[model samples]
Target: MAEICCQEAKSPPATVATASASAAAAAAAVASSVMDRRRRRLEMKRFRLATDLEESAAEYARAGKRQRLQRTASGSPPCPGAAAPAEAETVDPDRCPRYGVSSVCGRRREMEDAVSVRPDFLTGSSSSRSHFFGVFDGHGCSHVATTCQDLMHEAVAEEHEKAAAAAGSGDEEIPWKEVMERSFARLDERAASWATSRSSEEPACRCEQKMPSRCDHVGSTAVVAVVSPTHLVVGNAGDSRAVLSRAGAPVALSVDHKPDRPDELERIQAAGGRVIYWDGARVLGVLAMSRAIGDGYLKPFVTAEPEVTVTERSDADECLILASDGLWDVVTNEMACDVVRACFRSNGPPEPASGEGTSSSGKAVSRAESDKACSDAAMLLAKLALARRSADNVSVVVVDLRRGL
Candidate 1:
């Protein structure tokens, strides 16, 4: 019994267990550090790639080789030869930072059209910033379209500032809806003056000879959109349109203000423009519905007041499409939405965690992929419009709220 007790007195040392625990913790720390480093490197690489792509796009645009106007159909009237108004040519790309792709092949006439704006706002609250995107389709002349492109956003911003100041609102905050409305009004007014000034400066200009001899008579259709974090506000004057895709379906947001609708025909006739039916057709062969801006000479025949619509997007709203008549002439709102959705599904952006907030999470999921998808989609639309033999200049602006980055 004494010998058995002495043998059992010997026990294993405790050092081996302590050493094993310490080694496991050290390995874990090393693995975590390695993962963190990898994540940081990936993020940096993504940022650099996006920046380089954006810069390259800008340089391509500035080089002037990328802007080739689309041609008109074989028998279409030649595009008006007037130069884009002075202010129009000076559009500052820095103020608007958008990413897009455009192509124009003027079949019978020079394409005098413009599409898209930079997502960056020139001036606004840093916390509640907004993005501007638009498509201006010029028919009789490019001056009106170009002028609107150069100055429309600025006009909106100015009116917004004045309204906010008058109402004593806080810094950089303005009612975007009101601002958009007033800006459209202001744009018509400013365009009228600009056209008049150009006409006066060059009495012999060909654009004057083509229409009712007033600057307003030589007009282009406008479809503009201002996108905010919580809302999307669209304004349309003329036949241009703004459409949206919600949950893989198309929903038209802007009414096409044409000369044929009963109300529009009555208004056009009342304003002094002939809303006559050519042969058996109504509204002088014009298929558009409602009223529009510009067409100054037609002002008495057509009203400058635009139909405004403000929509609060649901969680399902996926994309917005703004286009000139060229696109609408060929593709319906539903078709446009379908194309965008297909592109999104096929070449969609990446999903990467950015921060802890829900908004950031959404942004990370939507905009993390390559911007080439957006550009490719827009180009595809324009190409399709052309293929459908859309006679007018084609311009399209596609805004992917989910993947705009």
Candidate 2:
């Protein structure tokens, strides 16, 4: 895309400027419309993906598994008649119960954002009913983000299993906060190793285009939320964020790590990395985040130590939202919460799954609107960001805590 700005360039006193206020406004409006269309296209594509995931969820229901989001009012008790969620429901340990949507928007031809939703994410009899959701935003390339999407959860699971084993059998609790910290540290080393191994196989060049240093400079920001019946834990490294809806209000679950922040700035300077102001405060004017995975070249300066927080689940905790910076760059926490609450509330009651009946072995199944609250909220948030002209790829994940996914 060509650079087209509404602001008129300074003209010499001798020349009458052709650019007018009305014309600039018209151009700006056109730009916004075009970006909106791009967002719509990406959203349409994500809807198709959501449709597939919906089918996957239906399969679980067909297999004697009911994954429904029980609607409970803010700070209210469970439905007066419905049976309350068991303190320890013996889940299949393989049922994944969450869904999300992702979109590419505005000026970027290729997207570098990746997201994941894993339920029953941990293995063995000890680890049960835990789900993980995340969004990864990449700079320089999508490889790092894609790689993290594929491997980070596995690392977390491995760490989780270790913690579970150490705690011993029979209803012992695991400290997920410590697990998140250790798992993130392990992923940093693993991502670095992945970049190194791939470079060793490729032919070397010094053009900075085909050279190994290209990937060495690429990195991705990660924000993850771990949800279970009793606990909600969030871990973040970079600008991606997680937010929870508490009684229809938005509460930030993770903090954005930026080079401009005092603590982040201090860390960079201590590591002999300059935080130069170039469009914005960047570590050596190259990276915007102070901590992230990958970016082998920026190691020591850009650590992958995630800030982890753990909280007990409460009735006020309605749902959770996770997204990349593209969404946050345009959407405020309050606006996002309001939009989601409205979208979800719009759906009244779930109808029976409608479609031609098919065996559980079949690949496809039908879905209803009532069960699609999270997916709908996620798609709308991405569109909202794009409509606001966020100039980056957008990704969103919405997990229904009431559903225990």
Candidate 3:
């Protein structure tokens, strides 16, 4: 530095000026490089922030969709302005009374239970509508249950339509047993078709992926109830059940198809199948239920023929319940009825209208309260089952049948 200064002093003023200018230019270049680096870092940070926000939004949307699906699957009423589930038929709320549904995985590894509710599914010539509610418990897969949820009601509706056409009028006293039998037969055929067809898109479950050839072993228990103004028709192909609360008394609408039952055992033996006691009198040491929708390998033994029951409705009827074995295993029919009754009582009644006739607004208020009570009852039952240590999926559907407040 001293040598340069001495040389500059002896050389010329122009030399000193030139050196200073070069030094200033170098400092400017360094400063510009630093600014460029800072600018690049800021842009990268902004990009990351935008990506994170988009991801968060997408996750939120997915969560909301899942919640909606769960609500629909559990038979809970949809929120105002929300779209109805694709599997359920559109319902006219005025014609359809309030109903509630609750379903949970409980302690199961995978959820295999499904519920379907289609209010006003079948309309008669006189504008009378029959509501449909069903419960399906799948074994070895969830596809079967989901399939039943999607197709069972439609199949039943088609059969009803056919019967109505043949009888020349939907208002005529149609044979419900024949109609239900035909519908179940058709549903079984469709289930078989669905299992065999590999051309269709894959399911979201691990059953098919784990064992492609195990489709024949998959099956589901179906308990369906068609509720009209005058009657209640219940059909059962397996252990799921339907019960009615009439004037606060419990009524078993459908019997469970257990393998150990005398009639079921006789039928299985007649079909050349044995009910071995592996995990509770399973047919051929495999399926616990004597009858089911699928199980092609055990078709002759595990029939799809549902036992149908028709009951005349009465003004004293309070509510109707349909549930999978998970609820029935731990809770008795009477207890279930009691729970629902208590819920109804807890909610009390809507205020009476001033006039003798019920105003439209008064009816709406009553319906809303009834719906809430039903929801509470169904949820409580499911929770009760869980608290009792149920090891399977729990599903419950509560249909409010009260005529007036």
TM-score of each: 0.65, 0.70, 0.72
Cα-based RMSD of candidate 1: 27.7
Off by over 4 Å in 1: 1-99, 106-108, 167-177, 203-216, 279-290, 350-369, 403-405
lDDT of 2 by residue, 76-138 (tens): 554456444323223232344445565565558778898877777777665447778888998
lDDT of 1 at 141: 69
lDDT of 2 at 335: 78
Error of 3 at 370 (Å): 1.3
Clashing pairs in 2: none
Report the Cα RMSD per candidate: 27.7, 13.2, 17.3
Worst 10 residues of 2 by lDDT: 356-365
For 178-263, candidate 3 gives per-residue lDDT tens digits of: 88888888878877886778425565457677666546678899999988877888999999999999987999999999999999
TM value for model 3? 0.72
Note the Cα lDDT for every prediction shown: 0.63, 0.71, 0.80
Off by over 4 Å in 2: 1-98, 169-172, 203-210, 349-367, 403-405
